[model samples]
Target: MIELAVIALRGVQYALISLTFGLPAFVLLNRPHLDERALQGLRAQVGWATGAMVVVVPIAILAQTALMAGSWSGALDPQALLVVVTGMGLGVALALRWVAALAEGLLFAFRLKGRGFWFPAVLLGLVSVVTLAWTGHGAATECVGKFIHQGSTAVHAAAAAFWIGALAAFLWLAFRPIEPGSEEEARAAAMLTGFAGSGTVAVAILVATGLVNTAFLVGPSRVLQLPQSLYGGLLILKLGLFVLMLALAALHRFQLAPQMAARSAHALTHLRRSLLVEFVCGGLILALVALLGTLSPPMAM
Candidate 1:
């Protein structure tokens, strides 16, 4: 169905945009912690993500157009598509998102991070990520609470992207950490360990903002009835996956990271497995997020 296509495209859009934002932001925050090789590797990932955004953004726009027009054929209708792209607030947001994504691609192609282009690239990526809030409940709240809901959604998304995107970077690094048992390996392990503080901060922000967003969507009174509603059920599933990710993150912080720091046998091996599983969970979360956006909350009903 056209609806399913929109959700699927939106998931891919979110995943790509989040990586385009998250990877560079993560490296910038942990620049000193990562050496040139690790930085180079992650930067390559950023470029790839940005490039994909250039293609994916437009496709997502068209899909939204189809949803708005109420048919697949309507997605290609010039007039209807134009209205969605040029007349509506969704259009404005998508235009900005696409432009920001394109700017990132151009910057990366011209050599990001070295020629004074990295900052602009980061800003563009942030724009692309935050603009996504406009398409969902983030920007749909009524007066008096509109800004609060939007802010919560934006911060929730950014924080989630940062955490999830960094995990992807870590997975890439885990698979090819330059060399094993060398200084590179130790520094890499240290980088992973160093993420504890910032990662915790990101998680804390996610929880707080998530609570705020949930209250606005589901209302506290509807909490007990959540299981009986489609939106609520999906939210519970998303929360379950989130908790699993948290549990894995905790294990990495308290157990595996220490073991890696001490050079225990196969510590890195254990880490690679955990990172893969965690990142997979993150991907599933994004998919659920896409689906959730299409369903009305119990409060709305």
Candidate 2:
């Protein structure tokens, strides 16, 4: 029950942090393609997310402390909290993450005169993602293995964040009713079309890094027996969702994108709905990841 509560608290953890990183990347990469309205909207959303993350990080640490102490009351113990903050890997990482979050929030709030402060925001965002690598299974490995494992994890996460960010941006752009031939519609199509090359690169990185991550977590000997364990089942479920997302992405690129280019009447509507579904799948993947991170792998058992 206690663990379940922790899992519930962390359900959106990945998505939340990823957005703080991905939103900046999206805004910067596609800034020219976006109108002032879209750019401001993204900046506002990311600012809020960064600020929210400052609060969420503490709550997450407290919840985690409770899980460690086996009760909510122990999480409040000052000595216990100090011990956690002092620890090198996870604790220190969390501290750095919080600082980055704070810095980002402050930068976003202040806003530079002509251009926004996205340059620093993007760098801090990368820092935040790197710190997260310390909190996962990759951090458990030793020596050279630790470097490889954590490195792959960080890249995988960054790629995933970028892909997810693009999907989110597309959804937001298309959510409102778009004029069939307005600049907004063209902008929307351009954003979708522009993502094709980057999306393919992201997929390649995600696939390669994903395989690398899975190998470290579930060794070859344990592969044959994965079907019998809860971890295995959940992993399979995650993989299925990923494949589904790929297929949906293909639909977007080939079918919907073409319709959008041709100025089909319902292109925006259809793309919006499909992006929503794909977004949901991405959410599910993150949730499953939150749960999976807590579970002991079959290889370990």
Candidate 3:
């Protein structure tokens, strides 16, 4: 029960942090040529997410400390706190998260626009996601293996944030009433088309990195026996959800995206629903990852 609570908290923290960086990063890269209203809406979305991360990061740190110490009281003990903060990889990752959270807070408070804000926010957000690699299975390895695993994991995580987080921002944009044949509608179509192209590339990266990470973590011999272990079972579930998300994404890219260019309401509605489903699947995958991080893989055992 305690572990479950920790996993749930970690899952939420991970998701929120991903969004905190992902949203701003998307705006920086895509810059979809949106109108004043759409641009303001996107900015507001990012601001709110960043502000929320400022709160969530501290709570996640406390929860992680307690989890590592084996009890809430122990988490507060100076010796336990010292060991966790100084000795553990997760501790370092948490510290990095704090730095990212502070940067995010500054971005939210000042609301800096133009290149000034974009450059710093993008850098901070990328660092936040990349630093998270230290908290996972990759950090447990040795020597050259450690570097390879961590690098791949970091790329995998960044790609996921780009795809899933952007989907969430796009869904929010879709909710606004877009009149048929208006400039706003055309911009929306263009943005959707642009995202679809980028999303395909991101998904390809995700698959390649996923394969690499899986090779490092689990060998071919353990493939058939995965369902017998808790970690492997959860991994299988995550993979299944990932496949479903890919199918939805394909539908969006091939069918819905083209129709959106024509300002088809049906396509827009279906795409919105698909994005929501994909976002939920991404959340579930993160939760499984949180649990998996706390367990020993079958191959390792």
- How well is each residue in 227-300 modelled by candidate 3, as lDDT tens digits? 99888899999999999998987777678777877877677678778888888898899888888888987657
The CA lDDT of each predicted structure is: 0.83, 0.82, 0.78
Candidate 1: count the clashes.
0
TM-score of each: 0.95, 0.95, 0.93
Residue lDDT tens for model 1, 186-234:
7667777789999999999999999999999999898999999888899
Q: Model 2 over residues 34-151: C-alpha lDDT tens digits?
A: 8777877877777777878898888877877777788999999987787787864777777888899998887856765224577777888889888778988888878898999999
**Residue 23 displacement in candidate 1 (angstroms):** 0.4
Candidate that scores best on lDDT: 1
Least accurate 10 contiguous residues by lDDT in model 2: 108-117
lDDT of 2: 0.82
What is candidate 3's TM-score against the reference?
A: 0.93
Clash count, one per candidate: 0, 0, 0
On a 0 to 1 TM-score scale, where does candidate 2 land against the true structure? 0.95
